[model samples]
Target: MGVADQINWVDAACWNGTAFDGGWNTRLATNQDVLEPATGQALWRVGVASAADMTAAIERAHAAQVAWAATPPRERAAVMLKAAALFEQHFDELALMIARETGGIIPKGHHEVRESVVLCQLAAAMPMQSQGQVLPSTPGRLSIARRVPHGVVGVISPFNFPLILSLRSVAPALALGNAVVLKPDVRTPASGGFILARVFQEAGLPAGVLQVLPGNAEAGEALVTDPRVPMIAFTGSPGVGRRIGELAGRHLKKVSLELGGANNLIILEDADLDAAASAAAFGAWFHQGQVCMASNRVLVHASVVEGLKARLVGKATHLPVGDGASGQVALGPMIDAKQLARFDALVQETVQQGATLEAGGTFEGLCYKPTVLSGVKPGMRSFDDEPFGPLVNLVTFDTDEEAVSLANNSQGGLSSAVISRDVGRAMAIGEQLNAGMVHINDQTVNDDCTNPFGGPGLGGNGSSVGGPADIDEYTRWKWITVKASVPQFPF
Candidate 1:
């Protein structure tokens, strides 16, 4: 059946051009069916926007950027403040919708919704707090640098953490006075894209100020290639991010990408075994281990490896898994069948080689049990490669240097964690690991609004998308000079 024929689609389908159903059924000729990963139910479908539709959307965003940029920063901040409240007011509805669309458990879905409110509030306050500086100049002349928005910004958000991930960038871009064209993941158009559109549009934001295009890669590519969009913000795999970065660089357009990471967690001899195990469990298994900054490998001291394994495996064995939308499971199903197959294949192949399948690592339907593997070595794929699933490989080290080497061995450096009895020692070890965000006694998946969230190497390029620093990413500095008298020049 065509997506237009689906009944639930009327409630969940993402908006097209700010209109309900947004004339997509008539203009868009192609459609992609969205499946509920846990239940295999046909939830809704997304339209593959034609080139004409994409062009029209970009043009509208471009036109809106002019007046929106001219509006005072305080007024823009007010709009964002209201948007934050809207998100809070509709938190329950959005959370349940997110759980259905993205397969996130109720608690995680709630976190996504609640945190988004804070993200918007924090971003709203940034324009007022962040200001340009004055530079020293000659007498009777004043030199100043002022920040200005880069006009229209195209945001390509991912499916995982749909609400927080998309809004984290959108809220900041809008707060900094840039009109945003959000291209949410096709897999999660309703909760990820359209809900945000509704919140902002209803909050009294002018028409065309925020547009949502719920399509696939074609839409994202069009947004990037369009001259109307001066900035591109994306969150996804590193390979895609690299290509986008190269293209944006060629076009002289501003871009920021929060890409993939194969992070690590180090457990010292003095570390508490139970505490370390709990942190590891939450980091590697939460959200089905889809977090980009999750630890792909755990480096533990040889003296305490056995004890930590006992505790971790026990937790993994008893945890329930499946049906995130309606059931209270410890870990939800994988995003889709393809993701499950990829994750299963990696674990199977690693076990076939030399690794021991300790506790879980089996799949039933689209859901997979939390898996633990030991005896993973350097050559094995599970050692360094990030599966972005509920899997963790354990490797032991004798000294702190070996631990540090194991941690920094990955090509990507998004985040890492150090667990130890000594805070001073943990801080010392954290300094040595090559990661963008390092946790002293916690897990690798850290997303604090106040901290700048990004990484080095394969992780990302350019500026980050969080904290007040984001003002610098969505806007550029321009120098203005005023003189009481004409400056004397040697002519």
Candidate 2:
């Protein structure tokens, strides 16, 4: 069936050069149902490509990348520019599809699509940027360095913010003259995988340059281990990222990992309580706190903890929560039952261990209430581990040193924030915190295509994406040298 026959991309299961209903090899075909988290409805069924299918996709991508690399840089940029225009043209339809496929609220879907447009536009500029540098060499020689794409790139993207994360790597790789074989999380096949293939194909990207394979662990392992694919871009948990890193290392393939985060939002005593509370609430509950940059830990001054707690409770209690596609709800449902259970367990364990549940410790179906927990201290489950949910753990601190110490006491080092009236003090505190990206007056959940994204430690592998970072992440440096004549003495 055509994708437009029903919802935007209902039957878009897998695309290997062309959209197909079953796997490339029908004998090994397997299908998995894609379910909507808010309502337990099956949005579509995706063909779960096996390891052999993944290998075939990689081989095809490798073959296509050579000609793509030889193509003129302007032609590549033109393709990216067309993709960006197409994204804008179909903005509403794509937003609705994101909402239906991923349970994202309408506004969040719009935001994701908007970010995607920026990503595509940013990629369009990459092909024209200076890829190398000229260096001074010996008297009779010239030395130069240039950037070039690494044949075929393998991408493993996550479900949350599927469109942005997938396109973050996919668009740049293609613009840099590399073919890509993308494996989006099985739960978000349409928005993350096949939909991209359709958009790029419509944008005039050549056949076989981009392959979307939505499958399970077998396919992921095959993609990582394949000798033909030399680079892997992954975004998900630290566990999976570590595994991919290990396998990619064994095979000598370069890998870029944008992994998990247990982010912090620090509130100082001199800060405005109302503004701090608002930032905390938004950071903790935006997209139901499914983001890796969600403010799981909110560290406030001991003297003003009570005031901030009251404000946070009021905001959490009043925020609407339900199906995102139905109306203007502030929070949407958890992605699935497994994620719901994980969040619930952390809250339960924290409360049992003596953290007071200030408000919202209830859930109906997948819609978890925007929750707040006070008296939460170090060693608490919610404080130590990343509760990727709409639950905020409030910890009290006595001084700026304590606040910085607490914020740095985690396995994650992604995004963080500081809110205070004194701009200088906020900047000082933010600088001391060991995080990749820090905002002085904003919340933790902030992102843009112009800035470098990804952090140190478990947050990522010291690799970044966006703007100039793309040249480093998607391409490699090659040094070239020329001499006026062959040296006779060296031989």
Candidate 3:
């Protein structure tokens, strides 16, 4: 059997103004190679929905949403529960597949799967809490307001955290009675497909209720522009997100963007150097810092800067970097040559600009060394740009005020963290930070199913997409009034 047959990918898009035929492609449609990042070799052929396919998906999903909205909320949640069970049963297999596609370290892949399972359960419980309000009314009339589904949601997910990001949106949308036309990043189709499409299919969701169309930018553009898709949930880089938001705006569609970060990890003078160093090492190098919420910039108090630097460099140099498929690798190769090249260029540029390369700045194949730079300043490119790799730019500040200034200096504000022994003191400093999600003695990479996620300014458009608050983005409210007696109006 072909890879498409094995994966059961949706092939031709039905754009002849009719219904989709459920066809699978004989071979990969696009010329793009689906490569294993560590080896830079083709893993498997991929072919999913095209632009026309996405258009058909939108129409079909719109049709499906009407019935889904009529289904009891508890019944809808049941399907989500079943899907979550399927995801749990196949957790290890799914994690391995994700590692293959995105060069995610094995532990990181497992972490994503576990988090996805929690999110699925959270989505399952959403329907029970999706309640309408009975408002106060006059004696002659009854007034009420209820939340209703947006019909269909267009989900555009990123390469990193492929399963968690895509399913996190898909589950909540479905729970609230909306269908989803998910366009996952083309580079990691299997990661999205296995966990989302296949698991949900096995869980017996209604046909066309959830369609995973894995293709390039054209497919994404089609999803964004489709007339029937009323709401869009996207997670990616800021530049692409801005463009997507612009197009969605032109079409008058609701779009939520969870863009990446140039986040900060602040170590106050009161922080324990050992604990701070461990957090810094993991925050910067985990999955080679491909995480959207990774701590790229570290602001250390001048009083403890030397001690923190010594511990951090000591910890970073000990991390083993290689292919994740190999035994127990602490760091993994970047997703592709393009990302590795970008990482190399930026690290080199920062070093040339006079930042001390204290620990690492070397690579073998796609694996870049975990690097630490000591002397990054306010205007340095490394301080401003989100490298999105295994590199940390260290900047020292004299006082608490200076550290807060250094932390809030960036345009991006997706994630921020403050390390201090005093909880009262750290949270106060956290309040001063400009990012959306603040961490007290925690890594910037932290997340949970119950907490709000996303950022402000350059990070994103300030839309939070997690927990109960996410329902606001996927559903809208409508007011209904019934008059018990005929209205007496003078015109």
Stretches of candidate 2 above 4 Å error? 1-28
Question: Which model is ahead, 1 or 3, in terms of TM-score?
Answer: 1
RMSD, candidate 1, Å: 3.0
- Whole-model lDDT, model 1: 0.81
| Model 3 misplaced regions, further than 4 Å | 1-32
RMSD (Cα, Å) for all candidates, in order, is: 3.0, 2.5, 3.6
Q: Write the per-residue lDDT of candidate 3 for residues 303-415, one digit (tens) a residue.
A: 89899889878877888888885657888888888888988888889888889999888999998888899999977778878889988889999988888888888776789
356-376, model 1: which lDDT tens digit per residue?
A: 999888889878999999988
- Residues 1-491 of candidate 2 have per-residue lDDT tens digits of 32234455333443322322223333224776789888888777767879988887887788888999998999999989898888888888788778777777999889988988888888988889888999998898999999999989999999989999999999999999999999989888778876677778778888788888887899999999999999999999888999999999999999999986679999989888988888999899988888989999999999999999999999988999998876679888888999999999999999999999999989999999999999998899999888889988999999899998899898766899999889999999988887889999889998878888889888988888877688898999899999988888965
Please, what is the TM-score per model? 0.94, 0.95, 0.93
Model 2 residue 353 CA deviation in Å: 1.1
Candidate order (lDDT):
2, 1, 3
Measured with C-alpha atoms, the lDDT of residue 84 in candidate 2 is 88
